[model samples]
Target: MIELRSQQGETVDLICRRAYGRETAENLAAVLDLNRGLAALGPVLPTGTLVRLPDPPADPPRVAVVRLWD
Candidate 1:
């Protein structure tokens, strides 16, 4: 599983984009159904808190899974 870390004021969308690519924020948001307030992302994720970056999924299936942040 990938570890999602927040960077002062980092949003769910920003996490996705940074972990994957520039165009992945929105897509990842859609996958998580989190349009706003991504602070509830994990047990360790706090608002504007610094966290780790989840690893990007490999090619083939192209699935953006929130499980990575576990």
Candidate 2:
């Protein structure tokens, strides 16, 4: 687990992206789970708010691309 102080006007998604290089539903849920009542703070977290980050996946899953025409 990693701890980070929230920046001014920073949202959860932004934080996750900065720390983990990507934001996904799973990560978001995990973060929220780690920090209870974080979501209740609203979209913009108060500056200096403490946040816990989960360990990033070793290999981020790849998404399959759908081709409209080939």
Instruction: State every prediction's TM-score relative to the real structure.
Output: 0.40, 0.84
Q: Mark the 10 consecutive residues where model 2 has the least summed lDDT.
A: 54-63
For 1-70, candidate 1 gives per-residue lDDT tens digits of 3455477656666666676665454456453543244445653346555444434556624567677575
Candidate 1 accuracy as lDDT? 0.54
Clashing pairs in 2: none
Residue by residue across 16-60, what tens digits does model 2's lDDT show? Answer: 999988898999999999999999999999999999999888888
Give Cα-based local distance difference scores for all models. 0.54, 0.95
For model 2, the superposed segments whose C-alpha errors exceed 4 Å read 63-70
